[model samples]
Target: MSTKPSLAVVERLYLADAMGAPLQARLRLSLCAGQGIVGDRHAGRRDWPGQNLTLVEAEEIENYCLSRSRPIDLALTRRNIVTRGVRLNSLVGRRFRIGDCLLYGIERCEPCRNLGQRLADETFDVPAVIHYWTGRGGLRADVLSDGAIRAGDKLEIVDTSGGLA
Candidate 1:
């Protein structure tokens, strides 16, 4: 059977401990990007294509951050994509096709001290998750087609070459 990976829109997107310019997000959660369209808000540099986490990571981080009264919440993050049914870690080295765009599985979304602070508990295995997912957190893909991507868009695993690597 094929791994049916699907995407969804969550009620919230969050940015933990972000103290710089406000990021822009869409309530739609997913957006369609066509040729010449900007695929990521922060695309370029080492953090190209940006980092995105699954709902699971967000929930875990939210609980940890909220307990510590940290300032990481949906209102703060403007993530363009919120995925469901797809584990951020499991996608490592895999190839994902969303609409006409393609992405390479890169890494996981790790929790930072900012996340711990946002939780207000300051006591969680934030480091462990981070360490495990570093460089393997979130799938980072170079724009393949720049097609319009929107919330509820379907993600297809076109290639399984990720596991071999």
Candidate 2:
């Protein structure tokens, strides 16, 4: 039997030096165990729940953009990782790996007014975007292992079952 786990692909990686700074796309992200994504705004931050990392589905963002007749600038999505072909919310409470980094999914990242304000511009309004992204926002995860996670890396749920001899 194959030991491979259910997998998902990391589509894009984003990082920012500080809060309110525009996020920059990166080819790889350095994850610090028990910390956060290196060089990211939330790195070393422990105050926020599930603040180690954030992930969202690219498909959901695309759908939202399509519905609003506006193109997406994924960086504005505010997620540290943009993934495809997986349901992030379902991974909550499960352990997973992306490249060499192991992580624990913590909770659903609920849309907040901060994100609403960020999405608002002359092109769109804040409240509408906030409500529109309700359940489709993203997932919050805790970094469990230190490693480099790159764009295009496969995300696999780690198996906890001890293998039988």
Alpha-carbon TM-score of each model against the true structure: 0.54, 0.88
lDDT tens digits, residues 1-165, model 2?
Answer: 878755589999998889889889999999999889988889889898789999999989888877777778666588999999888878887888999999988888879999899777776788887888887898999999999999999988785432211
- TM-score of model number 1: 0.54
Each model's lDDT comes to: 0.44, 0.86
| Model 2: pairs clashing at backbone N, Cα or C within 3 Å | none
lDDT of 1 by residue, 27-116 (tens): 333322221224334432244333432223344335434655676554322333445555556566676676556655554444455543
At residue 99, candidate 2 shows an lDDT of 95
